[model samples]
Target chain A: MTKKPLILVTNDDGISAPGIRTLISVMKTIGDVVVVAPDSAQSGMGHAITLNSTLYAEEVFMNDGPQKEFTCSGTPADCVKIAIREILDRKPDLCVSGINHGSNASINVIYSGTMSAAIEAGIEGIPAIGFSLLDYSWNANFEACKSYVKTITENVLKNGIPNGIVLNVNLPNIPETDIKGIKVCRQAKANWVEEFDKRKTPQGKDYYWLTGKFVNLDGGEDTDEWALENSYVSIVPTQFDLTAHHFIKDLNTWNLND
Target chain B: MTKKPLILVTNDDGISAPGIRTLISVMKTIGDVVVVAPDSAQSGMGHAITLNSTLYAEEVFMNDGPQKEFTCSGTPADCVKIAIREILDRKPDLCVSGINHGSNASINVIYSGTMSAAIEAGIEGIPAIGFSLLDYSWNANFEACKSYVKTITENVLKNGIPNGIVLNVNLPNIPETDIKGIKVCRQAKANWVEEFDKRKTPQGKDYYWLTGKFVNLDGGEDTDEWALENSYVSIVPTQFDLTAHHFIKDLNTWNLND
Candidate 1:
């Protein structure tokens, strides 16, 4: 008999969020689970680490779940780092982040705390996946997502992810039966068109609130945006390499030595 | 007669840091400059933006330099967004971030606030470059880098950066005469081996200070790490599209639905 795989679980949302609770419940059936997550919400943190200050992680009892849990005072990326470095006894078989409260589909992945955790784990050579729901509320229904999540997790364990890559999975906000299943896709060319809500404070100091509208510039059928829009779960294989290899020759032609 | 280019200058090291000050000086010589940077240090900010709070930007007099300056209460990415949306009179001809006090070579780009500003600008269809010195000190001499900075900025203006790409340039900490010119390279595969220094607070709470040693796993001669180590300025063409295009077909073969 094989030992149960030790799975590391985490999220951008605080340890107490409903989304993570749902994720924890699903993972408990699949592996020996250990969770280290932010003590408070760390949405939109990207790949930030706690470099300027100290970090604190205390083991806490959130529920009677079999999975060991720790609440960390750091970004999502830091949680993964501290868990692997100081908390865990050995390397994890897999790392899963989120079941995040919102979409991390296109350019949103660059600003996502949820994906950052997964990416951090991927960098550390762990097979990882970041899951997000299209719904962004405190009480978003994740009951419909449990079986699909389980299926994907099992498939990842069975078939290992290619080196330097992790899965960015986004599930549309619909009934699981209505879901058209998972589609392997590329990230869409999309961005948030920022609009600042400028205002003045009572002390007469001017301030602005960051707000944005999501815009999809790519019309291709093979993108994450299209899959999510058509009620399919999108699994985009994401990598940490920011290099644009194709453009190197062109850049080389520039007269730089002069 | 050619119009003077409009250049937007920013940094993760804050507006008052010597790094951005050096960048501003170089940029002023090339164009009509505008500086919008974070009011405080944001070293490990990555691609984060201020979402949960109000952002404030106040025009400040830093020096008698011709460039306009605004110190913002936000991350590096936020400075670019707010500049493009609320500050600048027109879309900038070029956006340059950093002259960062530390290296953003190899895998560090993923956690770099300096590169994030440049990537943010690239996403907005602007030709952008992020410059960093290997030296992490506040007093790292940037005197030797001025000519190289000007040359690279001019080349970007002359030969535009490809769409969906930006440059991550790292300079070695050596005298001007010792520098051996520039090399176009790929991001080396490297990561931090994290060390968490556990300590106790006065309240008897255990805390950790995050520290690490960077380990370069790739020995490729055509990598940014090699170039920087050899005392050459390294320029890696970076992109924001995180999609692992090569792995999509294999992911499609997974048993995701069943």
Candidate 2:
């Protein structure tokens, strides 16, 4: 018999989040699952690590699934770090994050704790994928997305991602069949037009809550935003290499010595 | 006579960090300066935001400089976010962050609060650059790197960074005469070999501090790391497009439907 892949699961949503529960349910069917996720929601945490405090983890039985689980008192990236360093006996074959409580499309991927955990795993040489639904509810409908999740996860395990790369997958909130299949697309050229909700504190100080309208300036139909809007599951093969290779030649012309 | 550019100055190392002070001094010679930085150190905070709490900012007088400064309680990225939204009267002609009290070269870029601030600016369609020194001490000599800082900042203002990119510039800790000039380079193939320093707490509970030795496995001399090691200012114009474009064709070969 072929050895089952060892899958490490985590999320920006808490360990008990409906999204993670559904993710765990799907992962358990494909592999020997070991789940290590945050004890509470950490939605927009990005890639933060808890350096200012102590960390502790506890084994918990959350469901009837055969997958063993643990709750960590840190960010989603922290859960992956602790799991890879202190929890797992061997390096996991795959690390999957989220089934996130919200969309991690376009510029949202940069601020996403969910995608950050997966990206962290990719940095550690583990093939990782972060899955997010367009719904940002505490209770999101993930039933129709399971089979597609299985197919993608299976493909990821079979083909594996390249060095320094991970997958950022976003599913639209639509009927399963109505989902017009998956598209391997690029990140849309987009940004959030931030509108800070400034308020006077009860103690008589001014403070602001960040609010924004996501603006997609790209007209390209082959982008992630286009794919999602058309009801196709969007998969953007993402990398941690931030170097803008194309601009090196231009920057080199600068006469810094002058 | 041409009006000097309006330069937006900020950092992750807090408004009073020696790095930001040096950056402000350098930017004064370039243009009109506005400083909006975190009120406290946000080391290792990568692209985090203030979603759970309200952000507060206040104008503060610190020493004699032409720049106007504000201290905010938020991450590096958040400072950039709010600066654009509520602080700046016009979109900044250039955004500059850090002559950081540490190295943000190679693999460290992913974990850098400094670069995240600059990347946040890049996402907002602004020309931005993040500067760092190889030194990581509060008393580290910024005086030694000032001339190069001025030169680079001027070059950036004179010739703008292209759309969809920002600069990650790391200066070596050597004397100006010994400096081997700036090099436009790629990030090296490096990985942090984390050696968690496990220890016992006061209650005898085992705890750990995340520490690591950086291992640069890439022997390519064209990388930023190689430039720095040779005592050169390494300028890597970083981009946010995370797509692994080369792998898209191979990924399409997968039998995803089955």
Task: State which candidate has the highest lDDT.
Answer: 1
Native contact fraction per model: 0.94, 0.69
TM-score, one value per model: 0.99, 0.98
| Tens-digit per-residue lDDT, B19-135, candidate 2 | 889888888887899999999999888878878888998899987775788998999999999899899898999999997899999978887889999999999888999999999
User: Best candidate per DockQ, number?
Assistant: 1
Model 1 chain B lDDT-worst window of ten: B58-67
Candidate 1: clashing pairs of residues: none
**lDDT tens readout by residue for model 2, A185-243:** 89998988889999998999999998988899899987899999998999999988888
State how far residue A15 of model 2 sits from its true place (Å). 0.8
**Per-residue lDDT tens digits of candidate 1, residues A1-258?**
989999999999899988899999999999999999999999989999899999999899976587899999999999999999999999999999989999999999999999999999999999999999999998999988898889999999999987799999999999888998889999999999999999999999899999989999899999999999999999999999989999999989989986
Off by over 4 Å in 1: none
lDDT of 2 at A86: 86
Quality of model 1 by C-alpha lDDT: 0.94
The DockQ value obtained for model 1 is: 0.93
